[model samples]
Target: MWTKRYSEILLMTFMSITCTRAESEFELRDVTLHIIPANTVERNSELNLTCEVNVVSRGGNTPDLKISIFKNYNNHNPVYINNTRSNKVTYTIAKAQASHSGIYQCDVSAGNQHLYSSEENINVTGLQTPELRVDKLKVTEGEKVRVTCSAREESGVLEYTFKNGLKVIYKESSSSGVVQRFHSLTSTETAKFSCSYSIHVGNGVLHSSVSNEVHVVVEELKFTAKITILPSTEVIEGDSVYITCDVEGINKNSSVLSLSKGSRLLPRNYSTVVLANDSGVYECRAKVNSAERNAYKNLTVKELFSTPVLTITPAEVFEKESFNVTCRSSKIASERIGHDDVKYFIYRSNKMISSDNGIYKTMAKNETNGNYTCTAQVNNTIKWSQWITFTAKVLVSKPTITVLNEVILNKPFRIECRSDRGSLPISYTLKQNHTTLSHVQVSNPSQKAVFTTSIQSIQQISEFKCEAQNNGVNSAQTSDTLRAQVTVPVGKPNLITVPVEQDITENQQLQFLCGIPEGASSPITFKWYKEKNLSPVYVTTVNFTNAEYTILSVEGSHSGSFYCAALNKAGKEEVSNHVNVSVRMARWKKGLITGVCLMLVTGIVFAFVIRYRAMRVKVASSNGAGIWSVRPPVLDSSEVVDVDEPEEPNVEYTEVLHPQNSDPARVPLRKGTDTVYSEVQSTSPEFHDEF
Candidate 1:
């Protein structure tokens, strides 16, 4: 058992070290964060925070980054976040307020690695004016008035001050920059109240401008009426009631007295058993001609019971769960005069659905969801509670993150997050590893949430995922990691000829290769083109970078500016630099030169045959033992002949002659003569009549 444990420990340690080494190649480092205007940011001025970081990637491609600037709000959630491939990110606050002053730090994430910057607590030099609100603008002397002072959405260790007409009435410090204070009216006068707040900064304090004033009036009674209810202030329905009113310091003989309920009149010093409206305000009026004084009081009539309140036993309800809805009142007037007094009925959308005596039970489902209310009744009196609503929530299934298209480096691509089953208004968060890329809320259940993003490196493909939430709970359903194809655009093609200068002669092999040095997507298609031609001379697709085109018998027609275009499945194209291909000779010109050379060789060989025949005639003549002289032929002659010796013996050359019309130097010596000798001439015996 000890050996097994030791082996397991070794395996775990090895795995941990291997994981660390793998991530060591990628680093998020040199993280530094700062703000503009080094001293302080004046309120209502533009402020900027800059986060700069340096990263090392696992490979040659740059790693994707997530930079966030966080404040002490909502558990340090990011106030500004950016999904980028750049080294620096800047967040701007167009109008800095008191709330903008706080401790802030920056976080930089590269791949699976993270780094954080030191915190910077900045100070805003100015403050916002607090707003003062009063619950009662007019009140009697010694009556309590509620006053609330609030700053502009500011928090974190603030001091609030409340003043009553330039006198400090209350002061308090709280983390929430809002405070409520109650001030009792002291005298019969109109008083103006205002408030201000302060923030503690470095070695000093910053106070806000005084808020707008709220005026409160304290009224003192001079001549008023006293009212009393008989048979107790709390009374049962259909009971007799008594009300008495007395006015102070009134001249009874000159002034007429009037007692009224709402708009009806009653006799003064009334002592009567009465039946009246269920609820109304009673007032006493003393009128002396046109000078009249009045005082009013609101009298609340007693009901069989208070308004019913409908509540669910469990605050949260999900589909397929069971809960109860109960209705009850705080007080009941003892079931006045009925058998089933204070009976309860529950309603669903104003339609009575349950008469279960203030309680109902049902399963939480979509079919059972609606607005519900309950009522308590006795005789003709009824009290209905406010409506309570239930919309059953459904737990979201695991989300699926799909890459809508093949991911292209540094180009925006769409990722869709979808849950097969969930309620409407689902919240989806797209994430890269542990860092959030973006958030989307899908209110329409039929549609999926889509987010668009780009990455700098291909390694981030496996790190992308999404999470869905709608249950109003802490847990969220997450999708599997993204898996999709990746493509890098082909770089510029480098085209080169076998002959570096691209000059080649006819019948010489010429080869040109199109290649990319780096950053090419395979398999790549290479198309070779000549100058300004729409069609390609050679087309090929290959997995390797280079594609070669060879011409075994190069022709002059192949000469011109030539280049190649390269494109991959990624659909990005690049053209190579053009190379001028100059062939020395054309096809027809070479054929013509060859024909002329063949004719020249044939003429030389024919001349040699004629000379051999002339030499045979000469040898026969020499055997005849004498030397013979040749004579020129006459002008305008068809043919010329030459004798081999002085004694003409052979029949092949009958005579040797020269042209008499031409000088000897001007005459042909061996060929091309106006008159020619036999032997080296076209007019020899070997010559046919075809000449």
Candidate 2:
């Protein structure tokens, strides 16, 4: 035991200074001293000790540095005998005596700094091994064992120790001891009793030696029961585990073997089969005629699961149709559904779905059309299968189209295309007069697609149609054409006569020019209304067509509140504000009218303009604002006018050339063109100027 402890101390010292002395982490100025014969040696033996000094530069000696050696590491009062001074030096002691055993160190001085080396122990032993003897060679259990040790001469401290293998059973420390008494020797085998002595000399060194071993026998009965299992691997459910109990130093016939769990007795055998519920502390008992012993072993059980197979019924599915997916597991079917059983779960697109009986029956929706799988979980154990893809096909029907608003020439309107039954991402194509107008793709399967478009002319009845197609690659289904009519809507019309007054003379060339806003469909029919009645006037001499009502002459019967209504093929009509016409005198008194008469006519125009502005303001205030609004303007021919409202705030109008008419007889009148009839034209196609 002392030898082991000394080796451990040497190991700890070596670990503390494993690195070179120059590379020490703690900024200590020191030297490393290594002494030969680290432990005790016999007296009169040669020994050599070396001191290697590592110095910090403080302008002291370099190559020949001053280093002093001391005995017992006492630097305050140095010992002059066998002392030397040098950068590196080794001291040799030939035939060392007991007085030479002490700790040694080296020191170096630089200006006001001093460096010290670690102390090294040098032990010179003069003691001899003691003689050990026992009173008897054998002893019974509970008997006092006596061992005696003696040294040839008086030793400092004598230690007597008795050991069985590496375990110390008895020990005693005394000065010059002679005997050691051990009580109740119960060791199962023969033990060796040894004696040794450790004495510290006057120079701080301990000399020690071990005596010859004296073997003593201890008589005692030690019975043991050890259990062993055949298969060491973890035992799962439904597995048969074999357990064996071995009894030491007992004959099979003399000893009775029995197995037990808690208080219940099992089959009496050296080996037994372990059950699933038998997972607990099990004891194996060996009973002889007078002695009995038992040993315990722990048993545990684990659970496992089998893979699940997923199946689908009526594998093919249609849009808005129902389908079923069944996940069957033979393991689950064999095992009863207890609190510890695994529950089945179905997944579509990595999202869990409800299936009470492992049979997932659900309708085919957009969200439910993806790859599916299933998983089972019991406690912390879970297992899932690979994904199975499922795609649904939907039946497409013919698309029906209708105009959401009145479609006019050069006027924006919307045409809606709808499919009654189809999947999402359906494409819609709008055609006018057998030509493609716009193509729209509707992402939502349930919504209709609206396309805004306009017509250029109403020379012939325009035919429009819409078609829908599903986004399928193989034999993609398309819808039939839903035909519609593209007719222009009449804009708000303004009635303008030759004379801007209500009072007019007879026999004068009085013409009613219904100034329609530009971009109105051609061949518009006009109806002239009179005084307080909604019914139109029927005159035999006048013909009203092409937005113009020509009377060719004025009469007293026309003096009333006259308003006009314009209609086109769009099935919508627009009525103009009424103008009061008062025929007070014949043509002879027309020149004799006063300023008040002129003022009366002016007041009527003022009142009409004021009322129109009020209506526009009311419409803008009610809703945030609308696309069409007009303010009373200072009329001038040179100033550019605007009637068409911009949809966005950042947009400004720029002119583009309009396509010329193909018919020569119905050519539009321009300022440069001389035609048989006089026509008033506006610069912008959407805004018309009043005459």
**lDDT leader:** 1
Runs off by more than 4 Å, candidate 1: 1-316, 319-324, 329-340, 347-357, 360-371, 379-389, 443-448, 471-473, 496-512, 517-523, 532-553, 586-631, 634-691
lDDT of 1 at 588: 74
The clash count for each model shown is: 11, 3
lDDT of 2 by residue, 128-217 (tens): 567877888887544566777776454345555655456666667676546566545554567777766655555454535777887778
Task: Please give each candidate's TM-score.
Answer: 0.39, 0.27
Q: Model 1's lDDT to the true fold?
A: 0.76
Error of 2 at 459 (Å): 7.8
